[model samples]
Target: MLRLFSFGSGARLTMRTSEDAPLVICGHGMVAQRLIERLVALGHPFNGIVVFNAEPFSAYNRIQLSAVLANEIPEADLALKPQSWFARHKVSVFNHEPVTRIDTDRGTVTTAHGRVQAYSKLVLATGSRPSSLGISGEDLDGVLTFRTLADTRALINAASTHKRAVVIGGGFLGLEAAEGLRARGMAVTLLHRSDHLLNRQLDTTAGDMLKGLLAQRGLNILTGQSPAALLGKSRVAAVQLNDDTVMSTDLVVIATGITPNIDLARIAGLQCNKGICVDSRMRTSHPAVYALGECCQFGTHTFGLVEPGFQQAQVLAQHLCQTSEATEFSPGSIATRLKISGIPIFSCGRVQAGPATEDIQWQDRPEHRYGRLLVEQGQLVGAVLMGDTASGPWYADLIDSGRDISGYRDTIAFGQPYCEAAA
Candidate 1:
């Protein structure tokens, strides 16, 4: 039998009985939710499942957070699973309670409310927290960071009263926030320390093109600049740049980057670098423990994208279910697609060409389209598609297959159909 009880300070406690089948999960985010869904798909009994959610709400689609800010979707639409779904699955969730400590020796986890839960197997999907710039006056009233539904609400409320806003960072999150705020009729100035936007994802050319497109949408892009300090009396009124330039602003959104939430794992003596270390099987240093999502490091890789986390969930679920065909996780070629409407940009695998790599590009200036393919030793290694991304999936497939395209090199830039016809 499963029972719900109110615990300390409005925290909800979900009691479950399954002494023999114990699996305790820490954190309730997209990765954790996916892990639960995958486990259930693999026939793991729901009675065995116990989840600790630090947030008051259930798992929501964080990928659509920008949409929420843009008013394209409501907060309710962000939920990944409804309350009825949990009730139907018989999964016990402790909301507004975070697992404060992990007692690996005793196979127990202590919650914020001092509730100790025992587990036969433990999984950490704590995800990542937004990184701060460590600048002065960051603690002001209007300084914000976007990571959760609550953050989105706060930004929306701030936007309602704020007329001008300055967004730090030109990465995906920063750009999304800038666009969302602009959609809300806020004058937005985007500052990036890099010479070009999305330095990690796109080359200078594509990035510049992106800047142009965004400029057309009324977003102020300031590159090679960073805020030295946020200035105001009690709230952020303006940002002082490193060059002593003062840009008056009503709100500040810091989307610099994210740091993995590994404090709990570190405190529990789990091996960690930038994130919790795990093997290809998603197993942590301890035998009965595993870690995944943005909080985990597999080899030299730490993933920030949803696809990798989802893949890890599937692999970990298979292992937990003791599937006959369980295999080690091998990450596929990750593709990034911007969620902003009207801006069609797709980047997969490598975006830059090394000395040994050859680049094939096709640019249609009139159509505002750009495509580039990186070939190494006769095989497609990477590709970038802007404006027209009809060939994104086909390019991703070719990169994954590692097939030599030397024969079709002449017509490959035309797209998959052209290459196929030529072959």
Candidate 2:
């Protein structure tokens, strides 16, 4: 058995004797696994817990989807701490069970399998679904969204037959899909609505350079273009742009974006906007109920990335264990820098330059390298670097922590020696 807890300041927790404490966790995703581990470590035992997960496996690292799609790693390798992890922790896992509704009044949740269970405390960790472009022929056979293992397996099989493929969107997933498809011997045409790829994470100049590098690898990149419609009868045959120009294609991969899955929370009458709203403690609007990961929006920030989701889980676990206190999330403002196809791109804070912000840029034409730093009020507000972005983390850390770097401002830009006392 385990201990049952209630919501209150300095509330006493009752440890279970013969009867097990009823603590139900819905959605067995990344954040849920971490929370489960934390609960186990805290000596909290659950009584006949019901965990609903749509995926067949217990849990897995979703960030490796691109590596799986690229055939760099096997599907089984993506799995998180195996099924034994749940067994050892004494948690009843309901894999492939999608929860339909949660009854807040009765403190219970109903699954698609027609099972209803009571809970002392409930957790919502239902992840997100792939965004679809509202276009004709989207339901066609060859059109796909690479979000799950099934989707990646299908894409790998389709890649064998398709000589040419078009990817819609220019974000991390879209670029990964394009690179993976290219690795599979398919000519990939990346169609992006924005003028720059990874626009949300990189500046226009760095994005353009990344596009050029991708193009040099025989990947066709079409920027500032939106798909008017998918030109196909049954399976995908081609994709038509807004200019009415049709590109030959056999497969159309749409990586537009992802929308958080908050239907269950909404059905249960929980406060939700964009995602399930939670405070620093990961506590929802309802008492004794909590949420984490991409499904929950904290402090007007919804982190779609894995690292931040894991960080949120760690913070929430600490709160649940009564260890370290919870802190407010400052997502989207945090440092984001990652490599795409060996090209380094980094961005943090406000890269959008204006009169209030001083923009200092340096470009090495021969090396196809560019770096821009945005300074405001004696602080490094933003930065963007490409080709040679090894110092991305160094610069991003400066912006995130608001470290004083005015002394080395000029030297940092052009790889120059500091101007004597300015150092």
Candidate 3:
């Protein structure tokens, strides 16, 4: 242990290094790999490196999980950086081994293999765990959750033989699961707890409209129903709804939601509420410890999606590289965009407005187009669009900048012609 001085509160502290002081990072998820690239660009060749509980092969692009499953792309094509990238950069990776615990006071991390190592700086990018439905038969062999590449492969295998597939939950993941199963030529049935599909992102009318469109295409959409249990001894056979309705299926894919992986952070006694609470700089309660990706909660929001997680990675990378100008995530107004089966859906900011706020919408159900804009005090607060998400970028920019659309409110509701008229 060596004594170190810091300006913060003018306090002196002792730091421990394992002969060589290195910046240790945990988890090889998206955020962790990005941080490594930034550090390398900064010309900071790590003297000692500790990568805990990750595959030694370096990080890969998880976004292509479905594409790989569908055989549209290979696994190698999905990798964000190749194995040679990590080797050439001299960043040691601990493949297939995950860190089980961390001791902040001792500055040590214990891997599942019982190897305990010390670190000077630690970054947590453990990502998220699938939100499982705590129901009977959840552990059945045929039940699956699509979160990792391994899960995708298993799902594709099971789906090939399964004639009927019942998907639990109708959020983004649920819909994706349904689409993937459909692509596999399996009869797909979607069971959702909400009255409409994508209730979280769309209003009731919009959700029902989308549900109708999906139903027209031979997809079964069941809404406002809860799964009582999974019917099968060792495998999923049927999904029992709340009303004792048994929907027979050979496989069940639960895409309910996800919770951040904060078990290690919690055990370390780090201050956490909802997620490992971190500041805009992605710094946790502990001084030398930082957390990024889905495991972190910043500004009262937990990003379950990948884009914001990537943004957090960039922010932390710059900060760690000592070239950070803005230590906060500038996401430019958080947006919800789902692109499943070549269909575009974009929802951003506040879709619902109170009495003081105003909402303008245009409906073309015949053409399967729905668009709504929420304006408060003549400024764009949020917007939602389905089938016609081409204007998503423009609306997103308006929401991010708090641009006023009072002058063109009526024109904007009519779609592109409004932009043309305004121009």
Candidate number with greatest lDDT: 1
- The TM-score values for the models, in the order shown, are 0.94, 0.88, 0.90
| lDDT per residue as tens, model 2, 238-328 | 8989999999899999999999999889878899999999987788999867888889998778877776777777776666566655455
lDDT of 1 by residue, 264-383 (tens): 999999999999999999999999899999999988888888888999999999998989988788777888876444678888999889999999988876576889899999999999
Pull out the clashing pairs in model 3.
53-97, 53-98, 54-94, 54-95, 55-95, 55-96, 56-95
Number of colliding residue pairs in each model: 0, 0, 7
Distance from true position, residue 124, model 1, in Å? 0.3
Off by over 4 Å in 3: 1-20, 54-57, 330-332, 414-423
What lDDT does each candidate get?
0.89, 0.80, 0.80
Q: What's model 3's overall lDDT? A: 0.80
Off by over 4 Å in 1: 1-21, 45-47
* Candidate 3 local lDDT, 115-136, one digit each (tens): 6667777888888888888889
Query: How large is the C-alpha RMSD of every model relative to the true structure?
Result: 3.6, 5.7, 5.3
Better of 1 and 2 by TM-score: 1
Error (Å) of candidate 2 at residue 32 is: 2.5
Model 1 scores a TM of: 0.94
Residue 366 accuracy (lDDT) in model 3: 91
Displacement of the residue 237 alpha carbon in candidate 1, Å: 1.5
Most accurate candidate by TM-score: 1
